[model samples]
Target: MEEAALLIDPEEIAALYRELCQFPSLSSACIGPEVTTQYGGKYCNIYTEWSQRDLERAENVKFCRQYLIFHDSQSIVFSSPSGNCTEIKGELLSRDSPSGAQKAVLRKITNSKGEEKQFLEVWEKSRKVKSIELTALEKHGQVYEDDQFGCLAWSHSETHLLYVAEKKRPKAESFFKPKAPELSNEEELTKAERRDKAVKGEQFVFYEDWGETLVSKSVPVLCVLDIESNNVSVLEGVPDHISPGQAFWTPGDTGVVFTGWWHEPFRLGLRHCTQRRSALFYVDLTGGRCELLTGDTKAIWSPRLSPDQCRIVYLENQASGPHQQCSRLCMYDWYTKLTSVIVDVVPRQSQGEFTGIYSTTLPERCWAADSQRVVLDTAQRSRQELIVIDTLSGSVCSLTKGCPLGSWAILTVDRDLLVARFSTPNCPPKLMVAFLPPAGKETEINWVCLEEASPIQGITWDVRTFQPPPEQINPQYEGLDFEAILLRPTQIPQTGKIPLVVTPHGGPHSVFTTSWTLYPAVLCRMGFAVLLVNYRGSLGFGQDCVDCLPGNVGSQDVKDVQVCVQNVLEEDPLNPQRVALLGGSHGGFLSCHLIGQYPETYKACVVRNPVVNIASMVGSTDIPDWCLTEAGLEYDQAALPDPAQWTKMLLHSPMQYVDKVQAPVLLMIGEDDRRVPPKQGLEYYHALKARGVPARMLWYPGNNHALSGVEAESDGFMNIALWLIKHLK
Candidate 1:
């Protein structure tokens, strides 16, 4: 057994991850001014990609390339077949721009020592130095969208910049808090205040999201920088209750429109609670004050103002409910201040399953060139579709239709056309340009490929779909049918079934789209068939399906996943005896629940940032309401849960099945995670250890619930691959 484990070549697994990471994963993109004839292409200048020769080098030492433009609507590979970033020539504006002809520059560098360093150099058109700067749009702690890279914008003229920065560090909270006078001498404090400060040492800080994400601990200071004048200003008068994000400049540069969370800063626990109250606000730059645009605390996201500033359209819930509220496209008239529901997108109309806006984060460039329409990314039948909704008529139309089994997003919007990046279940992201139809007609969007096939290409990705039987419950909310996407080798010999790895996405409210995923793809390359089930309680299936898992997260979700896995094992070429379970977040919670309940079924289990103990998590997690809502108890943010509630929560948690786990389990956790709390995974690890179940654990320091940080995520991904490969093989 030991020798077999040694032969599992971790380098190969790491290479696969590194190879995929090398592709510039384009998310938020902007359309450039002109389609230049240079390189016979116009450029979309800035993007994020793997930094170095491999994943480690890219994570530790990476070169930030300014722009990687599409060369004449043709797909091109930027790296060699063996996965090396190939240096290519471009007409990019650089400091040494003396030559009228484009020049070749050093394109790649290595960081063998693993030193923490970054290089930033700038020069004006004349190539001269200027001593000028702002307080830096940086923060003392992690920025709000560090993980998903959220809410970054450039003005219409691209001069002034607005971004979320950690303005200042907050003071620690004490059991016996002190109240300061309105007017006090800064030089001299009262004796009692001085004594209290001297005796107290900072302990635990209360957070509502991941660790150190408290708005009070390090508030998101809205900073605006004037690049031309070198003047920086921070917007003031924002109520202490609100934590602002997803901000963008309004038309004519009058003010900034942002999604603001109005919560008691003293009781900062709802920042990550999606069901919590949130609204839109306008920060008057000239007056230095923030005005509430939407007075009601409705869950709102991605407020895209029209080019004419006539209407501000955003995604909001039709009903005020916890996580599973039906989502709708709302347009607020700027002149009359009247709000109207443009479309009722949820409640599963049966005709459209993926019409609900992906809602978590809307693309920055959602508005059309005409501004009479808005383009959005929606989940339909487990696949991502980029649809444009007409503001006047409230009609929705798909931008494209090929491979509805994959994923798609509009990165840049130019006039009526869209520059989108998408991928299939087997393909990587390919940038293309598609257009919306004229006023009342529905036209199929023909995508013009911006770049060629991916750098690491040529592997055939075989993908298919399977549906599990409806739940054996009442027709109302139970047994709403769901689907799972299967991926494996394209060419399989007629023989025993391939090893199966069952995966469920996190966000009991989130669904697994047919997008290309690194983990599942790599596992498939490792000769295993992967199953991604968009089970009960997942989005895209509508509100009824989404609402199904909340009060029955453990039971309902576990059963759906089991049914899907059994279906795959029974019909497909999947090895039932070698089946394994993989998931993270709530997905991890379900993984643990599955292993404990059906202990003998799974041969191995791997979970990252899982919730093992809800009783313990309820006390420390940022979203305490999650514990209550998922456990079948109503959440009252103001009231403490009773003992009976605690008992029920414990029973609902995976802890109840600790004694029944028979699979060899591998646990991965972020030490600084505040969502589930590191203690949640640690407790389960120790419990399994004490029970003599074969268990191993890995913890990434300073990582939150999304353990996909550069180094931490790469290591965690490789280890998970190793663990699953070792056990399944």
Candidate 2:
């Protein structure tokens, strides 16, 4: 380990980064293995490996990435490789509906492979009809598509529920334009005024009717479909002007649905409400009546039923003060209709401050496996831990005390505590199971290997010399020095100097942790020195650190990257001036800003769906207005800067900076994206071309904000890989 620390080589680091990048197989492995219970047997594991021969077998092996786990029953189950947004559907039913039985379909659409793969497993008594085999069905006038990204949700029960609420839209026009508000005086309104009103008024359209109905239309629906019984009816009609965000089913399998919606401030008129509103409604299945569960709760998430089905478990969110810094978790009783604050997790430092992101303290419904206890993994004031609260006793115990906190997923089993987690600064994640000895015994965690564990220590990494930052760092660091992990190559470099790739992550709210397998290591192996800094505004450090990065603090994150870039160049003068900046989402925004403002520093840039104009992004993107307020962007029209100020924003926009860029650029976008919509990419690409700059843009027609799904289009994969190799080399 000592020799490993001291023997840093620049070329080796670059090589390591390159090698890390070559693992197309690595991306395929991101979707977690299938863990399912076999009949009369324990849970089984299925892993996927990328084979070169398989590449030729599939239409587009690069885009044909899926982890297929065939169960004993011949049921194939696996997640997509991209590990982003995807719809993974499996059929537990027969190919066709039974002669007289309703369909029990198993379908899930999620962001897995950086895009959404829609999985459909229709359950029939004797056999299951899998959608993956539906290519032949597409010819039969049936088009079954799944959207794993943004607002892609399924209503529980036999009811076909559709909750299309009005959220934010990306910069693209994949969907219908927003409708203009209806004028009370129709005659008084001019033709132009009516057209504008139609454009601003949001509407809703079924997926099948995507074109006829405007994309901005938001109509919430809940329907019951029992083909065998010849019963297909819309259970309840959603309120016309308001969007219904989320809905859930009753345990009795009735059409009864619980729904909620969230509203943000507007750019003009009576916009800029101090706090957003979220309301919960219970719709009776038999009767088309919806009664308010509670009058306008601040926020609610993950409504689950108790074993008896008398009560419900939901997360009640409310801000402590105006700036929305404080947060509390409360429970609402369905029978009594009473709500009470159950947990106060927000720190005192954030109590009343008009400065922070304390939106949801816990992940969404921290309900336990058995529902008798609610578990919360919090790192608000200190390191993260698991706090289990017994509903009956109302007592809270720290289940994961002293455990290194990272993102955690709870494993459902009998009386056992199993967590899927990765420690800090690591790239790979691990699954660990702990046994609570009987009722009275002490708690002890035992490591279980769902998959073989391979820490960075077990893998080979390219080492590069790091020029350390100057002494006298922030005192917030306490006594710890900013540590460095160097990778060295096996052979000396003959090339003049190796290139450096600085890949920053998105989520000014999220941090880079040391968990399991990450792509940066591959970049190092590919012969490029990669530096991943957990800069300011990164989470897990503390609330204060995260709060510092919003708004202009984003520049601080960039500043930190600049210092690291200079440090690497200084330590290894052999390093070429061909440094590149790469990032996605927030990181993409940073990359765009960096090259735009400091074009001389970085050679080439690869930005994915970046939020270019902060004000426009706040007004248009899918993030909440409260989040914008916390970031110091004014919500009111009066507070907003004049269009002249927007010129300054345009200056920082990647589109404006293309003229000064010294290197080639690649813009990747998903057409259907709602987050940082595909339009942002399109606009930027057009701007670059207008400047006669060397720029290329690749768009995934049916893709969304995150390219979370895999497309069986080899053309898409090669486009990006070829672009990088051509420009980087």
Candidate 3:
């Protein structure tokens, strides 16, 4: 079969490229606002739409977006200030904004018997002197004599005002402080001199000029406000020892409540420390007494009572370690007053550390009803698997057949598991939902067709063919097979051929997928073919491939890309006489080495934030200490063979070979980057200048390593397109 020749014009190709660049990359829309998570249902679940500009600044920002709340198939909870307030059974509450300005709205319904219930609008607006008031259905009351206070939760029964009161120490009292004696060697006084005088004072000092207030004592109380008589009584003792954290009553609307708390000194240095401990304490409404059910050692998070109220299930840290363990499902029985671990498994762990070598792989966690069973997703080296655990029986079952390529491939809600399955990098991922039955054959799973999620835009791509002189259509490799996607330019003359752009992805650990891209289309539109290689160590190929990424295996990635480019050039003699290699970050590092190791292979190069010096990169990144620990290497040059091996790094550094780079180069960086700091880019730029090489540096002032901010992201892609046009010209 003869293939049709591509028709392309340089002007038309550039026009389409520009239009595509303006299109948004990817964005997520809710499955109609709120989806079911727990009682009252969880709100945000975004299903991504790909046509949106990923570079848009506001897209990442979370704001006051309206979501629908479903009460039943027939009735729904709509949040609208314009519509009349309706009444229904069960308590309805508005999610509060972080500012704490407007009081969160709540609607309480006793029954579904009638559509009409008494309308009420009770909220507290801030003013100079503060007072709390409640008015509903001709019933009203005022209760407060405090400077300021905030609402936590209004009683569902409308009997109490659960709130927190704050008071600051007087400026005059806090300003008076003891002076410290200066250390003097000439005058040695009493035992205090030999033992070093210890200063005693409050941790913070208040200054009139600074508008700072010292905190001496803070107390929180649950109060009952008499709606009829207009009287207020403090439910907790006046000089309360308890500092409530979260005080939400149980499911049955019982007088007994749960309050989260931690001891003060134990919480010391804790405000700055990432580790936190929160435990639930039982408080009595009728009797002004509170009993601590659990100590501060255990972390009680997201506590919820069962429908029967007999058992409470919560995610918490059950292990005895300085660092909190990945959360596990724990159950506390009301009757037994005993807390037991229902399911123990690692929740997600931080990236960078692939195995338990230095850090454990954080597993994905999901719990079944009564915490009897759990789904665990664990990743190692590079492979990931889904395991079902019968916590009670200590039995485990495998759910998916192949390992997950990346962490985003699996998700769980309640007992239902959603797995993203893809056979290869070129194939799109399919979403599969399944119910893991207890003992018998696992229920058959069905994949949700996501073709609607297509026309997925914002992918940068280049696709060129490799015709290997007609002698070989395919090449064989021992470890992995090669795959390719070729795009014939739309208007190039059939008498001749086109150029090839070889682009490598940034993260040595990341990959180029059929997931869609923005750059290659621009290249193809510009009358050139592109070859996107999902080389070894690229994600979506399972754990084994990922594990092969480290230890300078990037050479394999380079080999794959170079072979594809060479094969393409062999088929078309009218094709480009010169090939250009380009990438950012780790990819930039590879590009730098390519020009040094195989100088003749590429005609020119553009590198952004390249790691010219690996040892230097390790020492300068945000988590230098963590990186050192993970890479198992010292900062000193002796770590590499022949301490002068640092010279290989220097020789291969793009900066060192600026004069040797016969090709034009464009370098870029974000000034605020902590990872592969801007210095790396600047260093190369200066070197190119010294060598009088045809090079230019483009910089964004306050951008991070990824160029994440709105302006930075936009500038990044735009600069790349412009740079390519200059080189192609």
Candidate 4:
């Protein structure tokens, strides 16, 4: 048995965390870039938001700024375009009119007493046109901001604004509360007064909302704001059970087109789950009628209208099984009301072939100037690549085929030009722009970098493919292969062997691309080799690979991770004895499984909000369907699982082998987590403690499953480093 130190230096952990905080990351970039005249030349202005750790606040502070990339008639200038801007408060969503003459901004203001108010402000040129308070007493409830049910769109005619907000409901009050004063004979009661007088004691009524991170978002309704009269009206004709979102003005401003998700069966966690049952809907305001655009499809998202407004292109997925899968790109003709699949799901792909689209959503504005081409980013193996699809011919072309080893994501498409962000595991993100080449000439794209790559001093990385042994491979997924990104330090240790830290991503359905990640880079800089595994169920390899892990979790995933580590150890200068594990959520489940199944392989393990017991988790997790489906069983929320089903779930859980775990474990739990309840980690901690095993647990209040609150993440990472250092030695 390996001996571990009982104490670790807190100052050492703090210093290392502070050093890691120096790397700034790009949080988000605006979709459209504006061309402006500056210094007697043409320049492209891109607004990007960045985040960096603030030790004083114990959280990340975001900075929204503009990047000015210079361009000329003859050539483009490659230089740093980083600049600064002041922060705005209470801003929820904002959009500019198609004519660029006016802007609409939505803000939610709250007083010190916790009272909230929503305001919609319209600005014309440099002057404020009007500001209207959208009060719940007179209008709807809070405006929807979650991606699944949020939109702020301007009509082409610029006469109205369309947005999604919560449907209004009567206020719940206590029946025994104080009564209202008697009205005098001269007093006149308005409609609002009359409605307020009918109070009901329904404060304890239960209403299920879209789970996890979407609090107070039960029902979303389409709202149209008439700028001329400043009157907001909730659109009718849509089914009462449907929640509308991603709305846009239809051609001729006759009505609006949006995605409607069914809430009848029950609302599951929507943040990363794209398999929700939904369809494209068109609401005809003039006729007061609603029409289903793509009734054949089960799930639909991001309905983007072409620049010519003749067709709508969107992504669709299967409505059942895994939370995510390869999506099919489909287009709808506005005139004929016909829908056709442009790219179907790819079940298998050979090496260097086009894997199916794994991106959850497309960029806001992705249409090319020709209106026949659409550009988007998707996962291809271990990296994200940008591709352009010709809507007319259905021909797919990779815009980043011959580029350097990195990930490319489209920020926005401006007519003939495309702005993208490129980054590698060692290099920070750099903004770049390229002109769309003529048809069949995509390989000749000339990319001009707006920001130079900032590479970390001692960090370097490469993707390594691993194959499971023939006997260990699942026959159904024989065509699938997994990958691990090995990030190493340039300066080798004195012993010529590096300690290894195996990191796996949370989403069993998610993939870890060859993109810059802070924690792995920090570990590499601290003389540790970090291996990020993309196991069989990870997205981007094809649909078959994703389908392989449903019934075989804890076994297939666990073996693939072991194979990856063993392969890396054989090919690289890594110390097999001094290995540690780091993961969160499903990844954390794998870590716990690996430590217990192969107790001698790892010396230390750390998990964040890990799923330890699936049987218990099924009752508390926001996505109960995930629990049943992943266990290779059917999901019927109304029915309770029998004894046989509970046994199967437990047999596939990490807690089944808890007694075999020898590695010291550190658990980081978010007290407010809804996806994977904190009790999951607490139960495991107590079990390990009872066994007299070395274990420690950290509890974070006001944090969710991601433990992503700035303070929580920072403090968690520091403790993780300390734990690994103390035990790995």
Candidate 5:
């Protein structure tokens, strides 16, 4: 491994990063795929948006407009959809009418003088556009853009629009400030007089918001816009304790149904946390009355209505336990007002059996033409597979079964035709369309490729499952096993064994699917084998697997990763002596633990926003509940930890074993990250430096926990490659 690292050129690594940036990733596909008569012939219309790196802007730019994808003589052709307009600037949210006759777009436009203004535009099918400037008084505050509390929806009649925004409040002012002079005429009062009447001394008040990625979003209120009258009004009677979002029109357009999150006790980090207490609610427009549609004890998400509007289907999970778990698919009958579980949570599963639904949310339009079958994507071990569930028969079938694609996701379902995106570790995402097969024949889908697969050269991948010996397995998780995807260069060096990089995903709850990920592929292209590990606690392996790591974090998860690496070394022709570690968040936590517990096993380590000391992090991180819960203790915001609890937390932290670390370390930190604060990395960096161990830290100013800004990611990856090359030797 040292010989191979010594032979690599730095210029080659930089070139590989630049080349990989050119590949566009699929951002989102528009729901309700259309079949129009004017677009050449009778062809399925698939619209998808893509995102790519913009090196000039130091950001990732999304092309939010639609692309027309159609089949033509054994090949797929891409073009612009009919009536597609030029992509708007600073567009925050957009929605189309049910009939596709009109479109509503929300944009934040800045004038030449640098004054920012919000505008709402309505475009008609006949090329007529109505643009309305929204003043601060009318909009209340900036629109919610994050997924947890943002919503923009059109009424069935298309005459009104409903969205979620910050609640209106009086501007804060100083209590002891001077009063404005009286104007001669009451009607000609100056601006200072108006400001004097506003509430005072509230600027410093701290209002808790939904944590992490959701910032400055404390109080979200539903607002409706009368398109014809050009008036906006906040919906009433939504209960002052809850924040509402994901709203849509009811069956008769007389009410709105949405998800309401309780903010009574406090708000925890909501992004990627499905266990937050939330429930379905219906608010009647005429009387301003609110009613609970689902019980308040469980978390619910994405209540998709059936095509016939007779029933609604949603996902439910435990409200306060694991952040991610096996969700139960539930349906609520509109007429009967009764909810039933269509698919219950599976505690455990045998090999190749249906584990359970492990998806955060379902697609906007997932119901089949018959309205009894629903199509959604879910994690099934090491891959993401598209599955269809029969609401009546309670039967589930995999639509992408027997297919080689490592990941499958539904884009939209138009009538019986389903549009989906699928990819493998070596292949980029491609579009495919398939007609829904009849019941019990879901696996026999004759898919028509809308786009050809673009496989990256010099990279090959295979999925490997690892199981511990009976004595080594945790007794509580007897049947538990883990999996890893090994990506290697197609042409290995003939002289030396290939160096290995063991990469674990961030969410201990998250699984590393055998999908096409850019960074891992880049490492393989650089002549390194990358092992993406999905440990015992990862999702898609049943609730038992997910529950295995919470009480046993820092030890069980660490051992599982070690077991995977050892098994891979025994089975494959990889150098065990040249092993390195790369991970972020909890994965980083595991990486830190590995180096300390088994210091001599790894040659180098790179951690991004790692959790170094849980005892210290519990007081600073956005999700304090995570610290206590993962440490096998119940979290109470009001109860402070005693010395005994602190000692236990410290025992599980990587800082306790810092003295045992042998590998040279590289710390990549996002300064503005809220999930795992930057101080976590700083503590580790300082500790290693004090001990005379080689260590380095790179801090990105505006990036978040993911360090996902295009420019930041590019520079970080380049630095990572260089650091690994320099130290592995």
Candidate 6:
């Protein structure tokens, strides 16, 4: 096993990363061609890959915005407006601003070496599209990722453009600083030497979800552009504390409505910032001033003005409790200065066939043309469902009933028609369209499947949901439970008992549903039965069930998983000894605990970015509330860093059973992970080594908590496959 581990090529990990990236990813329908690409009468829309932007930048310095049809899915054949078959490729542009004159840039990229063709393109509609580089201050200290044209917007007149860009922070001399070497010195420093030469303290500059690549790269700042004059200026007056995005033009286009964070410094870096405080604020285009719309209170996001421009609707959570709380549907009246709760509570179960309000925050533009109703995706019984909420009558209606079992998310919506990205347990992501029927005609709306993003074949799935007996559930969580999903090869193994891979999801708050996922698919292909334990504390089971994990972490949640696993093994021809475990973050916390608490039960374990010592992590992590609340301690912005809290945290931490772990483990960590710092993994790794337990660890540089840099995630998955083969197989 050591020899084989040594032989694993570092490049193969990158190859797998690219291979995974090539897998069909279905993004929301920001915009799609209602007519075929052949009808390119005026707006010749064309989409290209962003990674390939360097190619055109290096080779073709100048290009014209001529073509109109482009997208990121498959090279699809569709009828053009001219009645001819046309191919649409790259990602579809946002239809929200299609009425204006914009500048579009197109670039082509080679995806997965040769497996797929992808192009990165942006639309530039103005007559003369120009580019102006920024000054040191104009860059405004913001890193703008390809978050679907983030921080980029056009005014109502299409004359002024608004965007947020990254600006470099001035370097500061540190107190524990080392003297800088002369640049003209005898020898040049290697990259590693220069990196090591930089002096830094342990204090984090900002609390970011993913700590490394972005935080270090740049800060976010709002910018304005004059299209005809070819000039740019950084907007001022808005406080630097907030990181705002998803800007929308107000009624008169005189101001902007956007979402930004408002929290203490300790709450900065958490991935789930919504758990703290988020609000919709309006920014004056002229004065550059900003003001909070939702007041200084509960979390609110994704604010949208009614089509009539008189009313507004946004997602609101009234209570500031668990990170995974339910969203309340809020409505605002511009004239009356009154806000109403259109839907205050998520019905524990469907009222009549009407599932509860869509749980997650909506992306931009989910409103109907009449602006009377809104649509969003919801989680009910582990199924991704689509529903419409009528603002005036507070009526809830179901849109998807007979479609294949899967998940559906909004891509683009206009008037009553919506294009959604659909994924079933059986196949890859596909573009689907649905219409909102007036009031009573819910069943008349049909969800039609259209072009696939990237058609992935050979891989198939057999997934089912299991309800662990209520009697078998942890007594404390009895009657308050969620189901576990079991997936395997459609054809049962004929020989030895098939190995079982038990996966616990991160976000003890997050749920594992009957959706298509790559990890489980990979394991199933490797000839293992995979069971995803939603257990308690997961979503879709209602807020009461989700709130159960606070003080019960490491105990109740672990028991739920163990019982779920035992129930599955008894019902199937699965091996009881060769059980393999996989998880990340909270899931990893459970994995470490599972291996130690049940030392003789499992064969191997794989953990990525795990939390081993909550006491230590409470200080280093961005979300201190996670450690506090999960330990059953009532979290306060000020009353923490206490010894009483440490006792509870240590009790819940996996570190308590560090000496009993028997299963050989593989640890994958992101060097820049802020969520569960890399030290947590290192501590666990060294403990395993000291105990003489077989262990291996890998660290990906510059990756954040997710370790999702294409090559890094790929490397982690490939090594997991190799490691599992040596142990579980």
Residue 651 CA error for candidate 4 (Å)?
A: 0.9
Deviation from truth (RMSD, Å), model 3: 14.6
Error of 5 at 257 (Å): 0.7
**lDDT tens readout by residue for model 6, 86-140:** 2334322232343534543222334565532322223553343453433322234
TM-score for each model: 0.80, 0.61, 0.50, 0.94, 0.95, 0.80
- Pitting candidate 1 against candidate 4, the one with the higher TM-score is 4
Off by over 4 Å in 4: 1-13, 31-44, 69-83, 185-195
Give each model's whole-structure lDDT: 0.66, 0.45, 0.46, 0.85, 0.83, 0.65
Candidate 4 C-alpha lDDT tens digits along 188-254: 3554464554457788877788888886888888999999999999998889888889999999999
Q: Residue 114's C-alpha lDDT in candidate 2?
A: 58
lDDT tens readout by residue for model 3, 143-235 = 112212123444554444454333222223233565556656556465444443343454355322100011222344455444335465555
List candidate 6 stretches off by more than 4 Å: 1-21, 32-128, 135-139, 146-150, 166-221, 239-243, 263-267, 286-290, 350-360, 453-478, 494-496
TM-score of 6: 0.80
Off-target runs (Cα >4 Å) in candidate 1 are 1-18, 35-53, 58-131, 136-160, 169-217, 226-229, 265-273, 285-290, 318-326, 352-354, 454-471
Which number leads on lDDT?
4
Q: Better model by lDDT, 2 or 4?
A: 4
Q: For candidate 1, lDDT tens digit of each residue in 54-154?
A: 45443433333234444333332232122234332221112121121111111112248753222112334456333332213222332333422134455
Query: lDDT tens digits, residues 158-199, model 5?
Result: 899888888876677798978865656764465655444467
User: Candidate 2 lDDT, tens digit per residue, 400-473?
Assistant: 55465433433322223333343332334444444332222223433343333344443333222222254423
